[model samples]
Target chain A: MSEDHVPGFNTLSIHAGAQPDPTTGARATPIYQTTSFVFEDVDHAASLFGLQAFGNIYTRIGNPTCAVLEERVAALEGGTAALAVASGHAAQLIVMHTLLQPGDEFIAGTQLYGGSINQFNHAFKKFDWHVAWADSTDVSSFEKAVTPKTKAIFIESVANPGGVVVDIEGIAQVARRAGVPLIVDNTLASPYLCRPFEHGADIVVHSATKFLGGHGNSIGGVIVDGGTFNWMREGRYPTLSEPCESYQGMVLGETFGNFAFAIACRVLGLRDLGAALSPFNAFLLVTGIETLSLRMDRHCANAVAVAEFLSSHPKVAWVSYSGLPGDRYHALQQKYCPKGGGAVFTFGVKGGYDAGVKVVSNVQLFSHLANIGDTRSLIIHPASTTHRQLSDQQKTSAGAGPDVIRVSIGIEDKEDIIADLDQALASA
Target chain B: MNHDSYPDAYIREILDSCRVIAMVGASANTVRPSYFVLKYMLEKGYRVIPVNPGQAGKDILGQRVYASLSDIPEPIDMVDIFRASEAADGIVDEALALEPRPKVIWMQLSVRNDEAAAKAEAAGLKVVMNRCPKIEYGRLSGEIAWAGVNRRTVSSKRPVLSGGGFQRLGLGKGRTSN
Candidate 1:
């Protein structure tokens, strides 16, 4: 469809990246399960490999089915281009690989997903890439953390599990002053909740494994390049400004113009890292994305009711859902996620640790799982699970308390969700 | 003892035996309460499992990290929590689904959820609320040596009579002690 015919979110979700099969008239995106595609001729094959042309060469680098997903996600996120990857972690790795080299550094929020924290803290250390951790709640912290080596400032649009919302505009201003790009992980607050690009984020990433898949069936990730960051003006990014040795010394910035960084990620990063998304998973994710607006609406509405229910319950000691008026992040939520804060939130049981366990053990409707962003309700005790690797101090900083429980409200009937919670709390 | 009033003995035994907890939110930062409580639990020998999703698949307190209670893939007698009440429902739901449901569900100080508690109780799960497991364990295990003395000597001695009782005592006379 043309820009003038761009449809609404729901409509675009279902039809943006695909149409009926050109040959067989199949409605769904077909999984090009094969590993390689035949080229039109020797010149075409050479051009594909030389970046002179665009076509699928191998599944390891790209695939026709996955391409649809990338296009749709890029369109949905309002980005110039996107690259689908194996996982959210892989997406970060690929983005960093394309943006940073050994000895380069990046500034990131302290309140990021714990796995990302570990990746930046330990795994990235081997690559000699340093991360300056800053408090997402404080823009000044980010400013202080930025150094000459900083290539990007990263933060989650809404922090994971903790449900803390970052001020994208404020951070973007900081990044602009530092002459670096702002990379926002819009995983928790998917585009449906808040579009980070609209708020000045230069790049957006998602663990399409979560809400993007919605069904908990697929594991995938994507990076959406806003095409706003000027790589040529910045002498710092040699990867983009200089000629790439692997691509016959092609200057990505000069060749790709608006989409240099994204193209670099696809041709260089994914090629080396081998983190390309599978066509099958891409199809599943696209299916989930089709109902994105609808599911998010229900997820947010149910979460609001659940947050309110927990806030008022006698058995609830505290509630940290931004949807609640008294929550510290409520104002930010109103400013950012005006429709409602994303479904995930935390609360403490009145009777302490024992009660916390009891409540978790009693719920019948809610699934006790580690993953979030599912259509079904999911729960976990961070102190005993996802954050167990962190010390008490680290856990506290991450907002995972010993008596705290995390819930990802699903798109189920709000009354039923509340009822299960009611009974569980009573038993607790 | 009122059998209905006091927690079951088996539950008490289970609570007593557990040591060396991995509390996911065991905040090492002193400002966070979980820090002190985790330290206290560690001192008490209860292996506190620290399970923060953000920090998952790592090591805390020299113990390998697990992403969720189910992910532990080992015998965890109890799962202590310091999360919000809304989150309790899902945690409780997960706890019950365990192969051998946890012995106890302890909500930390200032945390509670009646429905979760009731559901756990119905599922034959022991539940405690508005109380930290570390504090309770210390108190019940005699680790808080002065707790009894403080309760008896300090609290019991302070007799603030209710309005109805004060009237019955006829305090208006300002009677001297004979």
Candidate 2:
């Protein structure tokens, strides 16, 4: 009832940007399963198109269903605005597209999702947008990677496959000094564990397909604008600072202050790139988010138990779960994700690649697939699947080495999860 | 006066009750934020007096533009500062000096001056900083949801179209309208 009363994480996850349906009185966020919305008049239509008013013209750019998800995630992340998109790759692409020009570059931590490393090193190069790789653990490496051509710095809150908890604050300082926005892929931590914005990230990205849509039934991503970066000052990001040619020459930075980046991505990137999240997927993702805190709590607790079980196993050569006290990232895990080490972590098999494949084949309860952050336990030999495109050195740097087996611990009882892993390890 | 956050009631009361608004540093450029915001308020049926030294005695969106807040002949209900933070200090002083001074001092987005806000609050004026009124009006009115922005309030109330061709659910508390 009071505006001063800010909503808590769990409360916002359920109701942040939603209201009962005005026309139909639907209680749950009904999928407004339409491609376009009708305008009030010609003037209204012009205003909506000209950016003079806030109204939906097409589902490609904005939708009521997607808007609620955007708002919920934004509130959870402590960001000003957010854009919901098709996938994590789409979110990354839209963000980079908005920030970089043909020759411009961005710095990314080497310890990232294998797909992201591929996207940065291979896919982004087609646009002539270069990515300078830096070590996620070493903050100085980010500073050294920054060149005059650098427009942004990218890192994962918790590196995928590797289970490395990055020093976001340390790297954020490097980003601040370089006068670029720090883009953190918070796919694993899921706001319940690590809020990148709280630690000085300028923009927070999520692969909602994983933890956010806990059921693994949907594929969606979100880009939350922290509203901290100034895009207009030096004319560095012309997409925001300069007059937009397509949209009545409205300089988005001046027109939509604080939330300008989100607007720019929506009007420029999503509007053009055409990778949009379906309303049904958005509804499922939002529903999945309702129990995010509950699922994440159980997932982390089970993960620690699984990590402990694997670390003591004779068949395991080494484990990379930050939840373990002896693990190298324990201190950082404490600092950033005190909740637990997170749901996913990796361990090396004694016999390397062949043994890892055997473990995947032997697991019964854990689904051997290429995904994380699902309510169901998933196992993958990333070297043979997700990271197969990368070179051997690149695979090791990404924590997807030939010997590594990654498991996404589920909300299921710990005993069942550990038994499955135990039987799988024995066979290996 | 914590400018960090504003209660929904505090903002709603100002938008619903304050009828006349004087937009300081109002721009003529159509793409500028001040221009569209003024247009939005005008269309929302509020009497908005544009204050700009560069374009005086002319009209902005058909409202007679005044050189300053002091030059406006009629009583002003609120002074929306669209200028930089440094310029808001002088505008607040000017608003405070006016006879029957305005009830509210609203600074536009990205404009924050704590000292000026404190000074204005000392004079019994309500202050809102680093926010957009058009955004708030649309938000409180629940019309911003039309554009995919988070309206932040959930309610059972349905929207009713106004004579001016817009829906005003008003604030979320079931209080119909001003």
Candidate 3:
């Protein structure tokens, strides 16, 4: 309880948003399995509904269990507040729903998870939200994409599968000039590796289904409000700046101030979207986060070793892990995620498409799957699986060329992981 | 001192030392943030006198309302400016003219005036801007953790709550020895 004592990352990971249960004094955060909370009386009910008080009413709006998860992620990201939802996709949906109006636009890095690319390109169009693609490796691409209609700029802290560390500060400047918020997807590099807020990002989004829920057991996503962006500056974002008819002319940006974006996401988007995370999944994710530092350390170590092995292998054409000193993004990795490159990266098999598929199918220890950031190593031949629908030109542009292979290195002993990949490569 | 950041000791000291607060622009509307902030301060055993020209002489959370700082008869320990940044200058000027002048001038969240802050600081009054004392109190006392927000500080010490109506924690325990 020293006056200036700030919690270490490991401490905040475990205890930031948690205390013992008040009613039962439960040491572990018990799952509040019920859907709704009972009000003490009519006055209390009125207060809760009117946003006059802070308490739980319905699980769809806010659950006690999910609130803990949201708080912990927000704390880790150095954000003022956070909101948790059913999946990473749901997290993205709620975020866009809050920021964008009909026919508005957001700029996203071209190198992204295929799922997000799809979400922005196809699903978001239904809401009349357009996605303008930019090259994260080149910050000027983001600058060129800026227009009056651009509501926000989005980038991945570390691009998925491509394994490039983005220059968050450079793009943040573009966002600043454009009068928009820079949203960084820190799913690849958890808070242990990189905190987006510290690098001028106005908001940080995470697909907690991956690294944040390290075991790959639960599906969840979180949005962390950096509390940096002034949502009222231009009145571009009416959801925050304007008065809400639903809540008696209360202006969220004026009332909530720094944490208004998070409040709006919860009270408006999630309330209507009905994407509430199950309490059990939140509990599991919470437990997963407690060991984040430990798991991430091993994840980074195993990934670097595996990348080194692949780079030297006879059948490997190239390895794209920034942890490698000679890799293109090595310097950027050091600048942003000095700890390590992270668990996910990509490489090229010498024999092209057939070899890539063979390597994935031949692995014993590595699970051939679409997911990453699991305790178990996962391998995917994207050209054959996820990118099959796209043309070869599209696949290459998306960083899923014919010879490309993606792997999410697990926290298992490095030698064991290398040994598994070695045999798999030999068979291929 | 940097207006963007404050040391924990600075914020903790201000919240702990100040007992009576005069909240300018406090509203009786339940949904407004100022209303809840006033309620929370009262619940935590801090006496908050509401100040609003419109709501003057009315009872807000059972505390007497005053039209202005000069009108209040009691010695104010702190003036919590819940008004906008443009209005902070006049509020600080009024606070500076008080007899046995308040020790602190605290601006609420997103309300900051550098000129007004400099004036207060020059007069030997501590100033904190763009921060909510309720959030700080909850953070320092580990009460924010109950709602799953990061208190930012780590502590193993259990909070000692006074025997009272609501179990609100205060930063007064360890500071008393100081």
Q: What C-alpha lDDT do the candidate models reach, one value each?
A: 0.75, 0.88, 0.86
Per-candidate TM-score against the hidden true structure: 0.69, 0.94, 0.91
Worst 10 residues of 1 chain A by lDDT: A1-10
User: Which portions of model 2 show Cα errors greater than 4 Å?
Assistant: B89-100, B112-122, B145-169, B172-178
lDDT of 1 by residue, A346-409 (tens): 9988876688778889989999878899999998888788888988887878878788889999
Model 2 residue B89 lDDT score: 91
Q: What TM-score, to 2 decimals, does candidate 3 have?
A: 0.91
In model 1, the runs with Cα more than 4 Å from the true position are: A1-3, B1-178
**2 or 3, greater by TM-score:** 2
| Candidates in order, interface RMSD in Å | 35.8, 3.3, 4.1
Worst 10 residues of 2 chain A by lDDT: A1-10
Chain B TM-score against the true chain B, candidate 1:
0.69
* DockQ value of candidate 1: 0.00
Candidate 1 residue A26 Cα shift, in angstroms, is 2.4
Tell me how far the alpha carbon of residue A301 in candidate 2 is from the true structure, in angstroms, after superposition: 1.3
In model 2, the clashing pairs are none
Give lDDT tens digits, candidate 3, residues A255-277.
Answer: 77677899899889988998988
Write the residue-wise lDDT of candidate 2 on B95-138 in tens digits: 99999999999999889998899999999999999999998988
lDDT tens string, model 2, A135-237? 9989999989899999999999999989999999999999899899999999999998999999999999999999999998999999999989999989999
lDDT for A332 in candidate 3 is 96
Question: Which lDDT value does model 3 have at A338?
Answer: 97
